[model samples]
Target: MEVQSAGKETYRAKTSKGEATRQKLLDVAEEIFGAKGYFHTSVVDITQRAGVAQGTFYVYFPGKQHIFRELVEELSHNLRREIQIAVNGAAGRKEKEIRGFAAFFDYVRKHRNLYRIVQEAEFVDPALYKWYYRRLAEGYVKGLQEAMDRGEFRRLDPEAVAYCLMGMGEFLGMRWVLWEKKDVPEEAFRAAMELIMGGLEKRD
Candidate 1:
């Protein structure tokens, strides 16, 4: 449970309206930050676009950087939640990997600003930028390790494999969803799955 701190006072949305206002601010910030870039975006810009007073902004986020950081954290949380849900319904290790990749592409398609905002974070907040991917990779490593334990995947370094998978998904999303404004094509998806399964499937 995260609370918004304004000076000495801690602000938690006490009502539905209050929570809606806070969420509105975040939603507007995501659009502005993605379009204008962090350095160029201002608190006034966010407040005006959100149709909220400048003081209201402080009630939720202390400043611009706080909102930006919160946005990144929110994206990370939602992404992992979506991927986990999809992977959970999968029948086996191969299905889990395919489902996870599909979930990621779908997420990227929905959140078109994802790449822009994340890339800007490298300069906006270095630790947070790294934390985003590291958190994602943590989930990947855990799942890969489980598959290895079950002998579904060969015993290679889970962390290394996690990063490799992340890189592949990231670029594929960038190439297809972000650039082409479409889902990853069936041919490309099948090829990637074949390449991954070929490498990971256990042998006698």
Candidate 2:
């Protein structure tokens, strides 16, 4: 699909073949950036790994920074979309949280490169790095606010709570799924949920 950059620069993949090529470049970028780290990976590295020419890289992305920014944006967007879909049709907010956390770990497992590329943004572009987390937190804040309004959760700072939850999922996913190459076990998932439920759930 055609995508416009934040600067209003258009990545016009005008044909099916062009769009495929663009996606191929991005796929290779994700792989290389995750494996080699952004600094060590060069445009030539991306092109060679993608089996595309140097000029072809320019067709989709202007330069390394621009592509890195796009990759961060894309990853941020795809993640939010996935989590939203995962939590859909849930029984309630509590169940939604459970499903959402499970979904997040599942996502991180599939996209094992998420942490490497996103964390590299701290050095590559600090603003974009913050933008990534802030964007993710926006959805979390909205959901938590809704849950509170529904009396499913206690009155608290939604944004702060969102960050707390996001932090929990980030580290848990990193340690269990990303690092260990395995799903979060059932007992551990329940323990984490109970710990969160203790504070978030409304009490008599």
Candidate 3:
């Protein structure tokens, strides 16, 4: 939905073919940007790998930076949305937290490029990099606040709690998924959940 164009018209893919081409470019760009640092990649590289004319890339994204920004935004949106869906129908805050971590690991396994691309955004566009995490943390903080109000979690600083949990999940995913090339082991998941559950859950 964050499509943009160089021209005043503001481009969008109106047909099936057009949409497919645009998606192809984004998919290829994700791989290219991940394998090669964003600073090293070019529009020509994306178009070549995507099997589309350079002009076709322009039809969807105005420039390399535009596509990178949009891709990061799209990734952030998808991650948050998936977490929301996974945590749905959970009976309690602890269950929601457990399911959310599972969903995150599942997503990372499928989109391994996300870790590289997100890190590169700090150099490519610092604002977009911050926006990505801030957007995710906003939802996390909201969830924490709700749990606190429900007496499920202790009354802690929601923002601090949000960052703590995010850091834990990020590192866990980085260690097991990105580095190990496998889903986090069941023992590791249980250990982490126990740590988080102890730290946040109310005693009484």
lDDT scores of the candidates, listed in order: 0.89, 0.89, 0.89
What's model 3's overall lDDT? 0.89
lDDT of 3 by residue, 107-203 (tens): 9998999999999988888878888888889999999999999999999999999999999999999999999999999999999999999999999
Query: Number of the top candidate by TM-score?
Result: 2
Backbone clashes in each candidate structure, one number apiece? 0, 0, 0
What's the distance in Å from true for residue 25, model 2?
0.6
Worst 10 residues of 3 by lDDT: 1-10
Pairs in steric clash, model 1: none
Candidate 1's TM-score reads 0.94
lDDT of 2 by residue, 70-94 (tens): 8888888888988999899998888
TM per candidate comes to 0.94, 0.95, 0.94
Q: What is candidate 2's TM-score against the reference?
A: 0.95
62: Cα error in model 1, Å: 0.5
